[model samples]
Target: MGLLWGLIIGGLAGWIAGNLTRGGGFGLLGNIIVGLVGGFLGGVLFRLLGLAATGMIGSLVMSVIGAVLLIFIVGKIKGRR
Candidate 1:
């Protein structure tokens, strides 16, 4: 199912983003949440930048980029709080 694939890719993207950002993961649920949101964000960002992601690998890369940006924003916000 498409939802299943989304979850899988999102989880993977989140995991990769976590590792890239903090040298670790955010657990299964965390990763999924982060990944899903990241996917959405990435889609918007890429489109705005005149980019279109296709296929599994493309989707994953976009998600990771968005996730990394999300994490960075969150960190900055948290730090300010």
Candidate 2:
């Protein structure tokens, strides 16, 4: 199912983003939230560029990009504290 794939890819992307940005992850809830947002952001970006993602690899790549962006934003916000 699409939902299943989304959860898996999003979790991976979020984990990767957190690790890369903060040297750690924000736990299960954080990862899920970031991942869900990342998936939506990825889809939006792809659409904005007049492109479409295809297959597992493409989706994963997009998710990673979105996750990276999300993590960067979150890191910046957290750093302000």
Candidate 3:
């Protein structure tokens, strides 16, 4: 199904993003969670900005970017503690 593919792709994207950004901080489940949420966030962000992703690759790219951004923000907040 579409949702299944989305999860798989999102997971992969998230894993890649994590590795690239922070040497892979979150575990598998965490990455997938971040991916899915990131996908939603990316879509919403694009829409609000009057932009659109082109295809699966584009979506994944945007999602990964969002996930990395989210992780960075989390890291910043956590570092203060």
What lDDT score belongs to each candidate, Candidate 1 first?
0.96, 0.80, 0.82
Which candidate number maximizes TM-score? 1
Query: Highest lDDT among the candidates is held by which one?
Result: 1
Q: For residues 1-81, could you state the per-residue lDDT of candidate 3 as single tens digits?
A: 888888886897789878978887377788788888878887887888898898788888889877877777888999999
Off-target runs (Cα >4 Å) in candidate 3 are none
| Model 1 regions lying over 4 Å from their true place | none
Candidate 1 at residue 10, lDDT? 96
Off by over 4 Å in 2: 78-81
TM-score for each of the candidates:
0.98, 0.78, 0.85
Error of 1 at 19 (Å): 0.2
- Flag clash pairs in model 1: none
- In model 1, how large is the Cα lDDT of residue 27? 99
Q: 34-67 in candidate 2: lDDT tens per residue?
A: 8779878888988999988889788877877787
- Residue 73, candidate 3: alpha-carbon lDDT: 80
Clashes of each: 0, 0, 0
